[model samples]
Target chain A: MTRLITILIATTLLAACSTQPTEPDTTLYNRLGGQAGITTIVDNLLFEIGGNETLIGFFADTDIDRFREKLIEQLCEVSDGPCEYTGDSMAQVHADMDIDNRHFDALVTDLITAMTEAGVPTGAQNDLLARLVPMHDEVIHAEEHLNGDER
Target chain B: MPDRKTRLVTLMLTGLLAGPAFGASKILATSGAGSIEGAAGGGLVPWAVIGGYGSDGEWGAAASLGRVDVDDFRLGTASVLAGVHDRLEVSFAQQTLQVEPLDAVIEQHVYGVKTRVAGHLIYGRLPQLSFGLQHKVNQNPAIATDVLGANSASGTDTYIAASKLYLHALFERDLLLNGTLRYTDANQTGLLGFGNSGGEDPQLVGEASVGLFLNPNWAIGAEYRQKPDRLDAVDEDAWRDVFVAWFPNKRVSVVGAYADLGSIALWDDQQGWYLSVQITN
Candidate 1:
C-alpha cells in the first residue's frame, strides 16, 4: 500500500512539471472591447503618421485608409482577440524598399505617438512591442539581402 | 621620419577600420552627449549629424577625435549629457582643441564649451523642438602669444541652434523629418574652428533629412547642410550628403554615407566615404 502511494505521488509531481500551458483565447474581440475600440486606435495612428512629411514619401503610392484597417485587423487577431491576419510576412513586403535604422526608429516613434493618442497605457504598449520585436530581424535582414550586404 | 609617418598613417587606418559602422548610436552636440565624436573635440557635419537612433533617454553623451588636413591639426574631447524625463534634454560639453601645424607636433590648445536644450513640443500639438548653444574660451594665449595680441584669457563665444524632429507613417511606409538651425558667434569655434578671426561665421546653418522605412529595422535617407563663411573676405561653400543605414536591432546599427565637405586648401573639395557603427543598451 505504501509503494502504491509513493508511485502516485511521483506521477503527480511529474504531471505538475509537464503540464501544458493553456492556449490563449483566440477571441480577442471581447477582451479588446470589440473591433470598434481597436479601430479607433489604428485610425489615430494612421492619421498622425500619414501627415508626417519625412515619412509621407514612403507611402507615396500606397493607400493610408486601407492600410489602417488592415493593421487594426491584424493587431486584433494577434492579441488572442477575435480576428484574422491576412497580410504578407513582415519581411517579404518590406524587402523592396531600402529600409534602414533611421526608418525603423521613426516607425517606433510614430507607433508610440499613435498609442498615446489612442489611450493605450504604457504597460500595454510594452506588451505590444514585445510581441512585434521578433519582426525586426526579418525586416532588416530582408533589406540587407536586397543590397547584397551582410554582417 | 618616413617610417614615423607610415606608422601614424597605419594607426589612423586601423582606427578607421575598427570604428563603429552605423555612426555613433549617441548624440553629438554638447547638450545631447553620448557620442564618440565628442572625443574628437567638435561637431563635424555628416560625421556628427549622420547618426542612428539616439533620442532615447532624457539625455545621452558622446566623445570623438578630429583632424583637419588643411590646418594639420588634431583634437580630442569628453562630454556629458542628461535628458529631461525623456521629454527634453539639456547638455554641457567641454573640449580641448589642439593643433599640430606642419613643423610643430603640438602647436597650440584651446578650450571649448557647448550647451544644448531640447524639448518635445506638447503645447498646442506641435512637434519636438531642439535648441543648442556652444561657446569657447577665446582668450587663446597660444594664438595671442603667437601674434603678440594679448596675455590673458578671453570671452565666451556663442552659437545658437534649433531643430524639429518628426516621425510619420502612411499605408506601408514610414518616414522621419529632421530640421536644424544654427547661428555661430564669429569669435567661437564652429565644429573644429579653433582660432580667432578664422573659421566659419556665426551664420545660420540648416539641415533637412527624410528617411523612408522599408520595414521596422531598415531605412534609406538623404540630407543636406548649409555653411556660411566666418571670414568677411573669404567665400565658403555649403555641402550635401546621402546615406544608407542598417539596423539589425535597436541595439546595433551601421551606416554608409557619401559626404561633400566643400573645399579645403589643397583638397579642392573634401569629399569622402564614411562608415559608422552605433551600439546601444
Candidate 2:
C-alpha cells in the first residue's frame, strides 16, 4: 500500500509538471501585424457578438464603447506592445454572472468571427486562439466547481 | 530553434481547424427540444436523432435512458429519435411511472417537420430562422380504473412550435438559440382524477435555449423551461436545467445534466442528476 501511494503521488506530480504553462511568446506581436491588426479583429468580433440577441443578454448592461476600448488595450498589451491592461481578471469579472459554457462558447464564436472579418487569415487566428485557449480553464469554473463537489 | 518553428506550424494548423468548426450549424441545448440526454422521468423533450440531416445524405439517430426516484415512486423514460431529408424527424418513447405495487406507463410517438423560412439579410444581418412544428401522438393509457384498479385519467394531445435562429459570430464560435412554445390539451397529462376531463386551460409552456460548439461535435448549452400548472390541485413547479453534450460523430451523442424535475406525486420537487445517450446513423 505504501509503495502504491508513493508511485501515485510521484505520477501526479510528474503530470502536473509536464503540463506547465510557458510564457507568452513575443513573436505573436509581429505575427498579428502589430496594434492595427489587433484593433481590427476586436472591432469585427464585437460587432458579431453584440448583434446576437441571445449572446447580447450577457452584456445587456455593459457599456459597449468602454468594453471595446478595454479589449483593444488588453489585446495590445498581450501582443508584446507597451500598453498595460488595467481591467479585472477574467475569472473575477465573470464569476457572479452565472455565465455557463454556452456564453463562453458564444464569446469564442464571436472572437473567431472577428478574426475572419479582419482577414487575419485562418493560420493566425488559430495561433491567437491557441494562446487564449488556456484562459477558458480560468473563465469556465462554475460547472467545474459544481460537479467537482458532487458525490 | 527547430522546435519554435514546429510550434508555430502546429498553432497555424489548429487555427485552420477552428474555422470549419464554426460552419453553419445551430447549437441546440441538451434539453432544448429533446431528451435531457440521460435523465429519469418524461415530459416534452424528444429523444431521437439530432433532428436535422448533416452535410452527408444519410440520416442520424439518438437514444436516451433516464430515471427519477422519489419516496417510493420512480419514473423512467427511454426514447429513440431519427432524422430524414435534413428536415423531418420521427421519434418514439416509452415512459413508466412505477409506484411500488402499481405501475402506470405512457407511450408517446412524435412526427416533426421543419423548413428554413428565409436566409436573407433580415433587418441588417440575421443569418436565417427555421420554423418547425411537431405533433405528438400518444397511446397506452394505463390509468383507466376499469382496467388497472385505479382512478381514471384522461389522455393528452400536444403540439410544439419551434424556431431556430442561427447566427455566426455572436460569440467566438457561431451560436444558435432555439425557442419553443408548447401547447398540450391532453386529458390525462396532469393526472387529474376521473370525470375531471379537461376542466383546466391549455398549458402554455415556453422554452429558450442557447448552444455553442467548442468544435463541430462538442457543444455546451443552457436552457430555461417553464410550464404552468393548469390544474388547480397539483402544484407543478416550473423546471430548468443545464447540460453539456458530446457529439463524437455525426450519428451519436451523449448528454449529462443537473436537472430540476419540478413536482411529481409526492417527490420533494425533484432536483437531481440526469444522463442520456443517443445514437443516429
The prediction achieving the highest DockQ against the true structure is: 2
lDDT of 1 by residue, A1-151 (tens): 2332353345434434433332366233443346776787677767776776445777888777677767887888766676788876666668877665445545656676676666654434444654554465567567654455434
- Model 1: CA > 4 A from native: A1-151, B1-81, B88-125, B137-171, B186-201, B232-235
What lDDT score is found at residue B37 in candidate 1? 26
Give the Å shift of residue B164 in candidate 1: 5.9
True contacts kept of each: 0.00, 0.00
**lDDT tens string, model 2, A85-146?**
88876766666676544455456657866776676644455556655655655566745544
Q: Tell me the tens digit of each residue's lDDT in model 1 across B1-281.
A: 22333344334435534554332222112122122222111133311221223433322322222222322333333333323323333333333334433232222223333333433311112344433434444423453324422223332333333333222232223444455565643322333233235422245556555444444445555556566554332334565545555656544445555555554222244555445443332
Best by lDDT: 2
Docking tier of model 2: it is: incorrect
For each candidate in turn, the TM-score is 0.44, 0.48
Error of 2 at A80 (Å): 19
lDDT of 1 at B224: 60
Error of 2 at A134 (Å): 29
Using Cα atoms, each model's DockQ against the true complex is 0.02, 0.03
